[model samples]
Target: MSKDNFLKGAAILSIAGFLVKILGAVYRIPLANMIGDTGIGYYQTAYPIYTLMFALSTAGIPVAIAKLVSEKNSIGDYRGAQRVFRISFIGLLIGGVLTSSFVFFGAKFIVGKLENTNAYYALIALAPALLFTPIMSAFRGYFQGRQDMTPTAISQVIEQIARVGIGLALVAVLLNLDKGLPMAAGGASFGASAGGFFGSLVIIYIYMKRRKKIRKQIRRSEKFEKEDTSKIIRNILIIAIPITIGASVVPLFGAIDVAIVMRRLQDIGYTQKEASGLYGQLTGMAQTLINFPQVFSVAIGASLVPAISTAFARKNFSEIKKTATSGIRVTLLIGLPAAMGLFILAEPIIKLLYFSNPLEVQESAGSILKVLSFSVIFLTLVQSLTAILQGMGKAFIPVRNLIIGALAKVVIVYVLTGIPGIGVKGAAISTIIAYVIASFLNLRAVRKYAKIRFNLMDIFLKPVLSVAIMSIVVAITYNIFEGFIGLKLATVVSIGFGGISYLFALLLTSTITSKDFELLPGGTKLSNKLKKIGLLRR
Candidate 1:
């Protein structure tokens, strides 16, 4: 794919991922209020297990398939690409079924070991999602490998729309029935399964519609070598396993925290109720806010994989360098401003988002969010660099780095949370340290493998300066508007001003130029308009 095509794919996925993150916030915030923090604790406990299983079952397989297919297609081996997909599809199907069964039948045992028996209902409800998501992922991988991002983007929005609508509706209905927290949380979990089912159907429809064209390509290809099914399967596994392990790192740490956090809190003299509530505040509220900014990184990483893989297959080192540099630059551009915004507006953001919650809950969550905000940049770097490494066929490097980071997190969480006054703040601090270590290690690996020179000024300094300007403007605007309007309206207006200020600062300082805009979807027209308006320099 050309650079324009690569940017277009990233832009499409970024927009879709952003929308999905918004829908996710819509689902989580209301669900938190309806179920309360303790209920959110139960819900979050089950969620980690589901995500870990998801990482193992679906995450790496799609990436592996995408890489394999892209490599084969780059050389005109269309038949070989199809064979990879076929074998991967069957492998994922069998794996998904087994994992789903394990989670469903073993739900009680799993949650029981974590000392949160109430999570069992939610676990069981989430099991069916596993059955469908792998299938959807296979179709998405196939399209993405061909450098087409529309299917993945469209399916994501559909999935999120279904998830929010069905999840909220189910929770509301179940709450009226007074089935208690576990059952209500279970109902919400069932909505996820429902969404996955709908998403799978959408992808299936897309695949069927394009099947004739896909087959035509396969039939038209001549003088191409084909690999046997077993060899294709082996290649898929070789690529998939390390990627799966690296992807699972975060979820594995999350699962560890689910088992450790509340139990340790209770061991430190908090009651079971207090422990669960605090855990909910940390994971449900603080972590949810942290995830909002991660959408951009995830989108960049997803787009980078196929682009870099295809470039690497063709031994196009120049394209690889350009793509890697641009990916890192874009990641820093988005992540720095987001982290600064979250830190500056942590309390107001918490108050606005969780206004329905008690003042104490909001305050507690706000404090945790302040600590978590620092993680945005590091986590974003870790994600982007890991993708670059994966594209370079050094997938195992990230797995090792993340494992080391996770170990540090576990030790730090244990020691700091055990302190008399620290409690959940320790977990937040530990998260930052973990990501910092992981990101630094990943960056080193990227530098070693890709041999790309880092321009510190372009990546960090300019963005930081722009964010500083934006922060000052935002603070002034918010303070002035607070007296005229309420907190919510003031917060909204201030954020709008901050975004605009940041953009103008970047433009004025030449941090963002016409070239950057040209990299975005619809960017050529936008760049022209901006140039006409004196906002962009040619």
Candidate 2:
């Protein structure tokens, strides 16, 4: 891939990613208020199971499809690419059905087996999402393979809008049903499934409209070949199965944590209701706040994968190293300050976002947020590193690292939570330790396979200093405006101010340059524009 082509792909992916993330946060905010922390607890309990199903059905296929299809198309193997797509669709359809079955019929058993039964209905409600998300993913992969993000972007925003509107409506109606909080929580889950169903339909419609012409073009092309359909089916399954298991380890570990913690808490004398409610506060309230800023890194990491895969296919090692390093650096740059800000401001933020609905959840939720804030920086680092290594075709390395981390987390959680004084705090500490270990392991894999060197002076010293300077400015401004402004709105304003200040400080300090940003995969034009507009003062 040429620099220009890579940039174009990155730009499109980043914009779509940002839109999707924004929608994710927007939907969550109102949903959190509607359901309260207890409802959120039930809602969150079902999430890991749903994520596991999503991973099972789609997992690594879209990525593999994106990589394989892009390579074949770039090398003039349109027939092979089309065959892969057809095979992917068939395989995903079967996977989706099986996953949905597990959720639909097994939800009660799964929930009952856990220490909590409050989330059983919510798990059942999310079953249809397991049915459709894989199919939606296949279409997304198809577009990504072609390096066209319009369909994906449009469908993503549309999906989120559907999710938020439908979810809010359901929650509101359920809240009024007098069926109580668990029912309201299940309503949110139902909304998610409804959103997925419609989102898949829309994407499928958009894809069919565009696909007919592509199929006709391929048929007319001299490059087209008549291949055995059976062979294509076998090849796709071979690629997707291992990728599914490998991709799902994180969510699987999460599900395990949910089950284990609930059981353990009950054994230690807490009621199921109390345990599940506490678990909900940890996942829904605390983790949600910390995760909001992480959307930036998640977007960057996700886009980096296909782009790196494409670069690797073209034997563009220079671009590969550059893109991978730029991705990690950017993740750290955005993630670290956000982590610090969250840790310092967790109380106010949680108070603002979750306090009104639950009433009694504010203090505990704030404490959980503080603990979780420490985890996001490491989580973002690990996430980005894994994406880079995986994109470089070093998938097993990340899998191994994740296993090591998961084991470490389990040990930590058992040891800490066993103590009389430490309860939910133990869980949060375990998560932090796990991600830190995972991040280091991922860093090692990147250094080993990608031959990327960490430059301490530039990557750590410069960005940290830039972010620190920005933090001081944010603290001052926040202190001044906090009295008049609510914590939620204050957080937004403070973060916006800090981000702008950090970029300016970086420019003035020569920590980053127009040339540096310009050399990034999809950043040349924007960098030049920034320089011209005096955004990069140095």
The number of the candidate with the highest lDDT is: 1
Off by over 4 Å in 1: 1-18, 66-86, 142-154, 205-229, 301-329, 390-393, 450-457, 524-538
**What TM-score do all the candidates reach, one by one?**
0.86, 0.87
Count of backbone clashes, every candidate in sequence: 0, 2
lDDT (Cα, tens digit) per residue for candidate 2, span 67-130 = 6677767767777787788788877888889888988999889988875688888898898888
Evaluate model 2: give its TM-score.
0.87
Judge candidate 2 against the unseen true structure and give its global Cα lDDT, from 0 to 1: 0.78
lDDT, each prediction = 0.85, 0.78
C-alpha root-mean-square deviation, candidate 2: 3.6
| Residues 1-538, model 1: lDDT tens digits | 9989987887788888889888886688888888878788888989998999999998878988899989988988888888888889998899889989999899989988878788888889998899988888998898888888999999999988987788879889999989898888888888889889999999999999999999999987656655778888888888788778877999987887887787778778987777778888889888888888776678778768877888888889888887887788778878888888888888899899878788998888888888889999999988888888888888888889989999999999888887759997888888899989999998998887777777888777887888899999999999999999988899899999999999889888767756555435566799889889898875
lDDT of 1 at 488: 89
